[model samples]
Target: MTAPTDTPSATPSTPPDLDLAVLHHLRGDLEGAEAGYRAVLAASPDNATALNNLGFAAAQSGRFDEAVELYERSLAIEDGATARLNLGNVRAALGDLEGGIAELSRATELAPGDPTAYDNLGQLLMLQGRIAEAEAAWRHALAIEDGPRLRTALATAVAATGRLGEAAGLLHQALTLDPQFGAAWAQLGAVLLLRGDVASAGEALANAKRLDPDDPGPRRHLALALLSLGRTDEAVVEFGELVRLAPDDATSRVDLAVLHLSAGRAAAALTQLDRALEAGPDDDRARLHRAFALRELGRLAEADELLQAIADGDGEQADRARQALVDEAS
Candidate 1:
């Protein structure tokens, strides 16, 4: 007969707590995740893995500064790749762009196969307008493995570089592998629009909306496609829905304002810029839009004030803003 074994005692046990914390995080329970991670820390004070994982949970919950401190503590104990990635992400969120870039720039070298590091680097590069480099990094992520969730990412990078047709092809391939890929269908619609095929774009965009009715990205893009195809009334209604859903989305707000401005609705454009400025005060793009709106409304003084700031190198958004200001002044 086999001897019966007693259950393991709980004294000094931390792996159990760490496992539980990860489980809670996966289940989307932030409060439970925090409690479990803290419990693990109580038992294993210098456990670098537990500390780094704890920092990831904190960052996901939007406690960015606390996350950075935890990641730093963990790194001091053990120079881990994951901890560095988490630290870089926190720095990115805190507006320390160069610092964030530097840390992420080093993460892949420390752990070459880290998908998160590649994705983060790709996103940061996209933000910097280095589309070619971003595409390469995102492609590297796709080559790692035919995982369950990487196709949409690859398609995004492909599309960003004006290769929408390739993105559409990948989205189709993704759906063939996983029909539940809602974002893929939506992005496929964007690709179709760039290919100048509005009918197909509508179908793809409709499929995306069917899969995820609550998301705003598909609907907003569908609206743009509609406008591009000369369906003005439908576009207007779609834009209205977008504004209702994401009142603080400055990009969508600016797009809406541009549509109105193009149609000679200066007052409506001003209202959109008002909302954009309120949501993104430091956004040079929104400020430029506001200046454009002011100029259209014959408010040259207000326009000049904003334009002068852009020319003074408050923060260089693009060459056009600086040139526009110079041209107007001369």
Candidate 2:
């Protein structure tokens, strides 16, 4: 995940004009904040705070290139932790992961005790798959300030390292701090799923879904948990809803098809597999599943042809196709 942009607070050292800009930013008025920051810069062209804040406003508005330029300008005028952090976030948003890491590390150096900077650095490190470094950075941030968000981030890094039990403990702590934290609940649910604790995973995911109904993360995990518990009917309903929510999601379509097939609903499975294949024509799993659905529907010729083609391939799916052919012969 890209690190969130910084919204620097106004300190006593802030100029009067820049203070107004900070207020506008805090009020979620990006346009007003940008205009106010521009006004401050117009009067005092070298105001690092104005430039940095404007960069933040631009970044929030999705104008990443402009945000980067503004942040660079701010850094040129006066090197500061805020400018470096904002620049790092913008660079990460732009897909420059290495550049983002460098800027965030510089931000940490500029503000050695700033937990936010360390948290941002940790996020970038995690994105880069540097789990050990990410864990260290998150631990540093937690040492400075044990916030719920930081704990969740740390849990993610720990989970990536396969310390799922420890990760679950961290997410549990995060939820205790803020029970309404849907993300923490969702993370805990995922960790439980990894541990094969389907019952607990389902409960946690349901809580996450209740807290944030619009989030697809909890819904996906909840569906998987239901499937693991042998509640294929309930899993089918959840997967159906997921397909509706994300029509173009080939993976969900395939998952729904599998549940339908398990329920002996070959026709319904065929429909979903057809759509999945249309969305991802070269998907071996979709083709393999489609062949099974076709065979179940008594379209033996079509099924045999597809299975033969799949069996000829040197992929994992080929073994399944070959097994199906053997079962048919028997």
Candidate 3:
């Protein structure tokens, strides 16, 4: 869930405690902020801004129920646009999609000129699979205020509708608007990869990585692009980095194992497959790959037993396991 930002404008004169609460919230001291907000509320029970800011602090602290209650009280006290927006986002985080849409829609109506409201509403719509509505909302946001983030969001909505080329163009425009936008570069790379332009995708992903070294998304896509381009060694290196960044990611470990098996490194493959199984014991693919690695190590009996067990199961992996058994017998 995106952390809610404080918008303390409803109160005509901010009390000292309210001001201190907002400062604490901005500084990430949720406890201090909550205390200050409660103090303000004690003094002025009808302070809508204090209520909203307290809700923001609560949401940041993962107290969604409290945040929703505070936001609802704030809105009841005063129909503030920021309160409505925060309520919408918190409702979305709580999986109340319809309720979130209603609140967000109300926020847009209350603040027609606010681009952020439209953008946020568009994101919730996209999450609900209402792509057309999302696209329209994003377009509305762009019309009100042009920015790289909104443009990129619009591009994502466009891409969801299968317009990859147009999405790429929009992402390019977003980059032009703000060349330092790492997210745009990463998104451009993802769209290029979907278009089967591995080389260009690699270049774009590289740029994204350069811009945001701490972001794992660009590196993950870059690894896939490299693998698709037959740069297996480089792909393995990138996958290693991904594993390092997200040690609990079984999928990356399985992927790295597959590459190791392809490169005839059965020992390495087995090691990765073991780690993958530890992370996700239900991963049939990792189990099957482990059997393959055992076969490569000349442990035929163990491999055969694993294949037979998998073939007996009523799962999608059964057919592949049966085929492996047949191939082994031949």
Candidate 2 per-residue lDDT, tens place, 159-226, comes to 99899999999999999899999989999999999998989999999999899887777899999999
Better of 1 and 3 by lDDT: 3
lDDT of each: 0.78, 0.89, 0.89
- Residue pairs of candidate 1 with colliding backbone atoms: none
Models 1 onward score TM values of 0.66, 0.91, 0.94
Lowest lDDT block of 10, candidate 3: 1-10
Q: Residues 1-330, candidate 1: write the lDDT tens digits.
A: 001011111225547777777778767787888788788789888988778877877777788899889989998998867777777778888878677767777887798887777778777777777778777777776777664346777777788878877888888898888887887888888888888898889889989988998789889889888887788778877787788898988888888887788888888888988998898888787788788889999999998888778767657665657888878869
Q: Could you tell me how far off, in angstroms, the CA of residue 312 lies in candidate 1 after the best superposition?
A: 23
TM-score of 1: 0.66
Candidate 2, residue 43: CA error in Å?
A: 3.0
